[model samples]
Target: MRRLLLLPLALVTLTLMTATTSAAEKDARVYEMRVYYAPPGKLDALNARFKNHTLKMFEKHGLTNVGYFVPVDNKENKLVYFISAPSKAARDKALQAMGGDADWKKAVADSEKDGKLVSKIESRFLTVTEYSPLLKVEKGAEERVFELRTYTATKGNLGHLNDRFKNHTIALFAKHGMTNLIYWNVLAGEKGADDTLIYLLAHKSKEAAAKSFDAFRKDPDWLAARKASEEKGGGSLTAEKNGVVSEFLVPTDYSPLK
Candidate 1:
């Protein structure tokens, strides 16, 4: 009789665990990052269309605008933006709906009357890391520069790279005055899923960002952690060439993040 009762309790616990895992999966959000290259003399027009029409249309179709930015020097005439959805399926559905909407069609037609504003576009899907801070922008926050950093792990060492960040690097970054904005993993089966870590950091200025990194590199704890991780992985976790890439960006005038 005791065994029968215990079996039922065990089943109940397993059921509850399954339900919790399902709920967590259901609530997970996916982020999309898109980069647009504007045609010569058309960058300002592209920005105007987004600021005036595209943003509102995105919200109308159920997409959440995360932020919009451009590089500090504007040499490439590129626009970078991020958006989020409850899931990839939801994001695709919303985009399809927006594409078919009459207003969106008209906006595109009107904006392109002179010429095509955008020359090319690149996109990637990302999911937040478990150790990342809640991705958000506080209302009325002061203006700041942002750094987008991408780390490419050496073959067979991506796990080690993630472990180092989860266990040591993030805290040390905070200790040196860098505001950890968000960390992301490229979705499975994507180009970089086997070996990439992408994250964003906010700083008071580009000069401040440089100084903060200088300090972080010299921190004894960081050096020790790097040594230990490399030893455990049997070599350097990151690739020897182009292992890390960084780009500094400034918020657009209409960006929510700034």
Candidate 2:
């Protein structure tokens, strides 16, 4: 009699666990990548606004602040950041509400009293790829260097590129001591939707990143995969000259994803 009762309880527990896992999978988060192009002399002001007011406003409206970064090379005076929501509809509603909040309005007006700090803003909505590892904020991740890589595929070749990564590149990266944090495709942006791949990687240090990549490039498996993909596709996946961009970043002290 006791064993019969215990069996029912165990089944109930398993059912609850399965339901929770299913819900999490169905509600997988959607991410937004935002870029603010600050005017030549106004980068500092823009950063100040975000540090002081914008991030708080975002939180109040139910957006999950991921991280904030500035490019190491500083080729353009830009601020980049990420945020997440439970779904695209939720993200849209939250942003609309944040836009109308009185506190946010006052903060924006006060920040621009001198002059408009940003010349333009660009936003991209992204959904994680099926093969992407779930993103997490590690307790000591602040000490790690993050690299954001963007790849532009040649016309009509994005699917092939993704296939290669899905089957080959990701494993090769792990073999070389690289951590694949997340992978995404641009849902909306100036760049065409079908041709872009963006992903983030974390490394212990800059030197470690270099060493890992150097090893990855020379691995026999990667070389064979690349050659076969190129041959099958009749050419390289990316455009000729400047098909890839990589930028190193450090998380801000207050960034939630660190």
How much does each candidate deviate from the true structure in C-alpha RMSD? 9.8, 8.8
RMSD of 1: 9.8
Give the per-residue lDDT digits (tens) of candidate 2, residues 1-258: 223224443353344334433443553688889998998989888888989998898889999888888876677898889999987789999989999999999999999999999999998888776566667655453478789999989988888888777667766676677777778877654356789899998888889999999998998878989999988778999878668888988776667655
**Model 1 C-alpha lDDT per residue in residues 111-134, reported as the tens digit of each score:** 999999999999988887766666
Q: Provide the overall lDDT of each model, using Cα atoms, as 2-decimal numbers.
A: 0.82, 0.79
Worst 10 residues of 2 by lDDT: 1-10
For all predicted structures, in order, the TM-scores are: 0.88, 0.83
Off by over 4 Å in 1: 1-27
Model number with the top lDDT: 1
User: So what's the TM-score on candidate 1?
Assistant: 0.88
